[model samples]
Structures are given as C-alpha cells and as structure tokens.
Target: MIGFVVEAECMFYQDKPIHFECTACGKCCTGNAETHYIALTPTEAAKLRKHLEVSEAWFRRRYVEHLTRDSWGIRMHNGQCAFLDKHGRCGIYALRPTQCRTYPFWPELMDDEAHWQAEKKYCEGINRGQVVDIKVIERKLKQQAAAEEHA
Candidate 1:
C-alpha cells in the first residue's frame, strides 16, 4: 500500500524574515457571514470592558458569546466583527484580542510561504513596510499560544 503525506515548510525553523506594517485598511477586521469571529480570553474581555467603562455583565451581553464551557468569542453582527466601525477601523483597537493583534503573522500563516502569499490577498500589510525579524515572529507565536492557554 502507498500513502501520501504533506509537510509544510516551517518558517520558524527556516527563519525567513517577512515584512509587515498595518495600513489600517480594516480588511482583517471584517468578515462575511460565513467567516467572522474573534475568540477572546477572560483577560481580553476584562481589558475591553475597562476601556469601554462597562461592567462584565454588560460586556458579555453586548459583545461576547460562549463558544464552549471554556471558550468565548466576540459577537459578529451583519457579517462583520461587532466592534468594527463604519469607518473601517477597530472600535476597540487598543484592547483587541491577541488573535487580532497578531495578524498576517499567525503561526499557521507563517508555516509556509504559500500560506503567507494567500493571506496577502486580504491583508495589505503583508510583505510590506518594516522587515520583521524571525525571532520577533517566533516570540509573537509564543505569546499567542500563551494567550490561548490562559483563555
């Protein structure tokens, strides 16, 4: 019998640097009905609520949904992030979840150049502006994993 296997190139191990700089075009913040949701940690929720000067109960009622007993995601309305403004900016930019903070450079996207190329279609910041070192990218990945662990 024959079997097929696919191995993705590891950008982290290969240490290929990539350039990125947010243009604030807000494409990443918007999604269609089929694919728009942002998971949030308890820490992220608290931070957002504090920024908005709202109570925890109010925050949950307005912006959060329980994905599972241990997982929570931001609400999506009208096929986009609930916190996205009409001006194409994040309404809660300062307190956006780690997932949002780490864009284009998400571990999965960074796994291979092909993934990064595909992502460039949506994110203008990809392969542009400052050349981010692989070490910085690795640190961001660890931070994302840590954030997910805590959440």
Candidate 2:
C-alpha cells in the first residue's frame, strides 16, 4: 500500500508584510447578525454622544444596543451600522470607535492567513494598497487589545 502526502503553499503568514487600505466600501460596518456587534468603550460612547450632541439616554435609545450591564454596541440598521450613510461612508467618521479605526487588523482576522482571506472576501481594500508596516500592525494590535481590556 502506498500513502501520499500533499504540500500546499501557505499564502499568508504573520511576518509576511501585507497591504490594506480602506476603499470606504462600508462592508466592515455590516456583519453576521448573531455574532456581529461592535464593543464600545465609555470614552468612545461619550465621544459619539458629544459629536451628535445627544444625551446618554437619547443616544442609547436611538443608536445603542445594550450588550451587558457593563457593555453596549452600536445599533444595526438592516445588517449595517445605523451610522453608515447612503454613500457607504461612516456618518460619524471623525469620531468612529476604536474598533472601526483599527478594522481588518482585528485579532480574529490576523490570527491566521485563512481568517484574513475570508475577510478579504468582504473587504476589497485588502491587498490593494501600500504594504502595511509591521510596526503599525503591532501597534494597532496592541491598541485593540488594550481597548478590549478596558472595555
């Protein structure tokens, strides 16, 4: 009896330099309904509230979904963020959350090449722009981890 072993080329690795630039497609704002929810830190919520000139109660009612006693997320409108405008732009772009600012670089997506490839299907910006600096990726990853820890 003969057995065969197959070797497949690995297309992505953590050390491999990658390129990503937001196309402003707004795909990242929409996610699986059941598991997709943006975690907001207190500072983020406050920043958004201030930007919109809305009170906490008013903001919560119009744009927030309470996830837990200590946590909440931006409300989803038809599978997309309520703040996502008709032009596929963030309505509150200047004040978007840490999650949005550090997108595509999320831990789950960067943990493996397969995860990154799966995300590429949703994000046209992946592999379309300048090669992302390894330092930037590390910094962004650390920032995300800190945000999670604080939240």
Candidate 3:
C-alpha cells in the first residue's frame, strides 16, 4: 500500500445544493427571546420608526428592549416578536432588520445538514424549494455579520 495526502474542500461543500424559500411560517418569530432575539442598531431602529410612522419615544418604548445599559434588541411580546402580525407574517417585512432578512441562511443553521434539518422543524422552507446558491449564502452571511457587528 502507498501513503498519500489529499485535501478536501470545505466540509459544507458536501452539503451543497441546499434548498430554501420562506413560506412566511413565522415560527422563527415566535420563540423564547433567548433563541429568537433580534438585535438592532440605533440606525436600524430609526428606520423601523419611520416605516411605522411612529414617534421616536413610542417606537423605543413599544418595540425596543434593553439588553444592556447600552445595547438593545427588538422587544418580544408574549414570547414572540412584536412585529409578527396576527396572520403569522412580518408586519414590517419590507423594513425588517438584516437579521430578519437573512433568516434560515444564518451561519449557525448552515453549519451542516444536521443543523439545517433540525431547523426545518421551525421553518418549513428549509430544503423545500429552490436550491440556494452557495455564493448567495455567503453574501447573506456577510451582510448579516456586518449588521450584527453594530447590534
């Protein structure tokens, strides 16, 4: 027998061609704050205020939760997102935070097939629709990371 060394591409490459398409299930928005907390920057909060046509004080008082003396996140109501409408849809889908926009494509969920499938319990869109391109996933990840950096 002969010995040889070989390298494989990233482990995730093996799980390629993953499929996802948001069906607006809203399960992700309805969870304990720890698992579903959506952090927000001051600027993101301001945008949301403008979108809802609410005053700064009302927006902060109604929709913001202070995680720390200086940090804040979207307020959770009855263990669900404040913006999740009664119909299980995002009320501000057009103005949702980066965290909300890049959903199941998060780095944690895309870790491997197991994570992806595990999350399927909450989000029916996983592996159920169009095949998500790896590059698009990468881009979304980067965009989310950047936004979270300010959160």
Candidate 4:
C-alpha cells in the first residue's frame, strides 16, 4: 500500500473552491479589529424574532443598528456582534442575518485576490473544508442579496 499526498489548488471566483465549518472561533463575529456591517433580510429578521421569542421590531431594535440613511448592519458590542452569545455561538443561528450566513462567499466583495486575502485574514476556516462549487456560491449570494433587497 502506498500513501499519497494531494495538494489543493488556489481558486477564487472560479472552480477552485473552499468550504468551511464553523470552529466557533468567533473571529468572524469580532469584525477584524474594525466595525464591519452585516446586513439582514426581513425573512432573517422574522426568523430571529421567532428564535428569540420577541417581536420582529423588538429584535431589530435590540440587535441592529442602521449605519446610514440607506444602509444597515448588525451592531457590535465590545468588538463582538451584539447577538453573539458567551459560548461563541450565534444566539439565532437558525435565522442568522444573510451576511452571517454568507461568510467567505461574498460575490460583490471578493472580486479579486486582494479582497479574498483580506477575508482570509479574518476567517480562520476559510480554506479548511472541501472545495465548494463556484456556481453554487454565486447562486446563494444572488439569492441572499435579492432577498435582502426585496425585504
């Protein structure tokens, strides 16, 4: 019997894919030493409301902060997401914001190697899993962003 070593190819915005399973590292929630925005959709908002057993308006009031007149994202407390629990898990994982669900797969954001590298610096799990199909990623990104727009 012989053992073989396989090297993964580096691919971004192409067939070279990456997958990630959350290690509960909480680095992604901490916003990379700066404030980053995580936008939500109405569907996500409703789901979070159900999870938290609160009204949608109340959930938004407590956990979300509008960044500008036309943009919004989650609010952070002491560098971590306001909704991040002490155990380093999302309190509303089932209904987490679209932004949270789309880690390492933001189409608009990861247009080039530099952008991908920037994301990798913050998310330790970025290149750790099985290769993800690029088309699947693009579809998810489109669905999430469109859903947000409609919401």
Candidate 5:
C-alpha cells in the first residue's frame, strides 16, 4: 500500500458545495429560556436607529440593553427577540445584525460537521436551498468574526 497525505481545502467548512438559505422561519429570533440575546454592535445600532428614524438615545433605550462594557445584546421579551413581531417576523429585517445575517454558517458551527447538522433541527434552511459557495461562506464568516471582535 502507498501512503499519501492530503490537506483539506477549508478547515472550517468540511462539507462539499456548502449550502444554506434563510427560510425566514424566525426560530433563530425566538429566544429560549436560556437567553438568546442578539449581540449588537455600534454600527448595527446606528443602522437600526436610522432605519427606525429614532435618536441614538431613544433607540438604545427602547431596543438595546447593555450586556457588558465591550458589547451589547438585544433585549428579549417573553423569551423572544424584542424586534420579533407577534407573527414571528423581524421588525427590522432589513437592518438585522451581522450575526443574524450569518446563521448556520457561523465559524464555530462550520468548524464541526456535528455542529452544522445539529443546527438543522431549528434552522430549516441549513442543509437545503441554494448551494452556497465556500468563498461566500468564508466571506460571511470573516465579516461576522470581525463584527463579533468588537462585541
């Protein structure tokens, strides 16, 4: 027998033809008993403020809750995102944070096959939908990582 070594193209995403698409089921937005705060960044806050035509002070008071010195997360109401409407639609869908924009393809999730598969239980868009290229996934992950770095 001959021995050969091969390297994986991407250490994070092992599955081929990476696929994902948001089904807009809103499960991600619904916080559980364990707390599902959406970590918000200054940039995200500003965007949301402008979208809602609210002052920084007003927005922070109404939508954001300080989590720590280095970061802030969304305030949940009845164990669900405050921005999530009664119909389970994001009130600020267009202005959702980077973390919400990148769900199942998260770095930690992508780093492990089991992690990725486990997400399918809640996120219907995980294993189905359009075949996302690895490059796009990497870009989203990189952007998310950068945003989280500030969080």
Candidate 6:
C-alpha cells in the first residue's frame, strides 16, 4: 500500500511557525470522513454542558457517544455534529469540544501511518497547505491536549 509521508522542519518555541487558512469548504465537516471525535475530559464535559446551557445528563444523553473503555466521541446525526451550524461554522465555536478545536492536528491519534494516509486522501486542506514545522505542530498539539486534560 502506498503511504502518505508528512515532511517538515524542526524549530524551537520562539522560532516555531505554522499557519492554516481555512477555505470554509466544509470538507472536514462532511460525513465522518476525516474526523475522529476525541473523548471529553470530565472538565471539558462540564464546560460544554454549561456553554450549551443544558444539564450534564441531557448533554451526555444527546451529544456524547461512548467509545472504548471510559472514552466518548461526540455524536453526529445526519452526517454532521449536533453542534454544527447551517453555515458550516461550529455553533459552539468559542466553547467547542477540544476535539473540534484541534483539527488536522490530532495529537494522540496521528501515530498510525495508515490512518494518516486515509486522512490525507479525505482532507483537501492537508495537501494544499504551505510547509509547516513539525516540531511546532507537535508542541501545539501537546499543549492543546494538556489544556483539554485540565479543562
């Protein structure tokens, strides 16, 4: 099988740089194509509950889908997230789940080469973007994961 390889430079904190300009194509939002929902931390779940102004039980019943072990992936109905708006923008953009906020840059899930290739095939943004420093991306992903854990 032909695999996809990601190439980028390494840099320190001050010099690390990366940029992505979303075209608003909504390709990432289409179906469950390129996205895999990350399990929400307890704090994250509580925050989302408050942000959506719903009870924690209701939020869990409606929006949270159980994955392996104690993990959960956000549930989607009819090919879109429950929180995805008509304009292709996240309804809870400001307080969206950590998984939604970290797109094209998943930390714990990107280690599999086969999965990465599958993602590259489905996401147009991945192939067209300018070169980014991998070390920078790694750092940002780590930070995001840490924030989610603490949220």
Question: Each candidate: what lDDT?
Answer: 0.77, 0.79, 0.78, 0.65, 0.76, 0.60
Lowest summed lDDT across 10 adjacent residues in model 3 is found at 1-10
**Per-candidate TM-score against the hidden true structure:** 0.84, 0.87, 0.86, 0.73, 0.85, 0.63
State the local distance difference test value for candidate 4.
Answer: 0.65
lDDT for 103 (candidate 4): 70
Candidate 3 lDDT, 1-151, residue by residue in tens = 0110011124363357878888878888888887668877888899999988999999999999998887778999998899998887889888888888888766666666687788888888887888878788876766766676655
Clash pairs, candidate 2, are: none
lDDT tens string, model 5, 1-151? 0110122245546466667878788999875735567889888888888988988888888888888777888877787888998789999988888888877657678766778888888788887878888777777777777676667
Candidates sorted on lDDT, descending: 2, 3, 1, 5, 4, 6
Candidate 4 residue spans exceeding 4 A from truth: 1-11, 32-34, 55-57, 147-151
Q: Ten residues in a row with the worst lDDT in model 2?
A: 1-10
In order, how many clashes per candidate?
0, 0, 0, 0, 0, 0
* Top lDDT prediction, candidate number: 2
In model 1, the runs with Cα more than 4 Å from the true position are 1-9, 12-15
Best by TM-score: 2
Q: Write the per-residue lDDT of candidate 6 for residues 25-88, one digit (tens) a residue.
A: 6556557623555456666778888878998789999988777566766677677777777887
* Model 6 bad stretches (over 4 Å): 1-19, 30-38, 107-118, 133-135, 144-151
Q: TM-score-based ranking, best first?
A: 2, 3, 5, 1, 4, 6
Local accuracy of candidate 4 as per-residue lDDT tens digits, 22-72: 577878888632557677654566666687788767877887777666555
Indicate the TM-score of model 6. Answer: 0.63
TM-score of 1: 0.84
